[model samples]
Target: MGPVLRTEHLVSADQQTGEIASKIDAALTQLARARQIQRQCLATRHGLSPLQLDILMTVAAGEPPEPSISLLARELGVSQPTVTAAVITLERKGLVRREPLPPRRTLVRLEPSGQPALADRPFVDAASRLDPALQEAMLEGALVMIAHLVDNGTLSVARTCLTCRFHRSDGGHYCVLLDLPLARSDLRVDCPEHQPAA
Candidate 1:
């Protein structure tokens, strides 16, 4: 060989691994502390548990102005009983109401008292702090992630066929919301940015 290669030319693998580990540890610690703060804030500000706040937010973001317990359970990745317990607590606090839908299904929605909590200043402040472009990018990324999760069976669609505005429950199959015919393939469609009429 013309010249001996030096081991010093190569970077230390251990150093690279240590850097990555440090980053990961920092991320986990931050997440844990944030979650603790979130819990405490909910308890102190709204007098509600974190799960109850989650349930309220889920209903507020749902398609039909309200969501069933099954929908909440699916969205939260929890058992029906867990959702039921949260709903019961929310109801006791007058934060949510369970209304009887036509037929037998029950719809859960935020009570008047809960609307202010749902529109909490902290969430608004955080959203306002984000750049519009960054917010849009984040929403798009979330949608992509949700699609991937559903495709991989890690997430489940929860809204009922009839409750969906795009679903044609009557004899004809058309979406009143879209003002077009409905396709069978679009049954489980959902959008986080969907807004209802004023």
Candidate 2:
């Protein structure tokens, strides 16, 4: 027969697992609530729907090699058509523009009209709702969770050096993938070069 587990030990293990699960659930719930509150405030301040505001924010964050509709859809966890529809609405409002590039790729960027929205107090106030240390902790937790989800196939996006095998934590952060050293603050939340750790 296999080794038998003591009843007391089993009960203790079960209780510990339950407590951890509850804490995770609470954290997720708090994040969801914060997002909802921020979305509501953004909608009220900008006279835009939450989805529109989300699209605008995503587009606003786009750097060179601007984000495509499909990429935005992937990041937002929505259908491309849904993102496209929102883009159309945003275009009508002069908040965003679609620039056609060669070879049939379209790039999305925030228009001048949308810049004012980014500077509004609602976004700042909502962001500051959480304490700075708490926000950093939450972001770190989120990055780790996202890395886990990506490894498990529950999520497909959010590639970061933290999840890459080449990431080294000795003394300071370093990435073998890029052959570059990274500072703690310089660590990217999303990196194109991220290769999942084996």
Q: Which parts of model 2 are misplaced by more than 4 Å?
A: 1-14, 120-139, 169-173, 180-184, 196-198
| Candidate 1 per-residue C-alpha lDDT over 1-198 given as tens digits, one digit per residue, 9 for 90 to 100 | 598878877668998888876985697688669766866686669888777887887787756424887766777778988988888888998988888887876789778888888655454577578987776555444444455555577755623333343544455445666676644434333544233211
CA shift of 75, model 1, Å: 1.6
Query: Residue 19 deviation, candidate 1, in Å?
Result: 8.4
List the global CA lDDT of all models. 0.66, 0.77
Off by over 4 Å in 1: 1-36, 64-66, 121-124, 141-198
Q: Tens digit of lDDT per residue, candidate 2, span 1-198?
A: 999988766657778889997999897898789778977787778888888888887777664224788778878889989988988888899898998777876778888889877664454576579887776666666676787888888887666767878898786778876788985546777676666677
Name the weakest run of 10 consecutive residues (lDDT summed) in model 1: 189-198
Return the lDDT, model 1, position 128.
Answer: 76
Report clash pairs, candidate 1. none
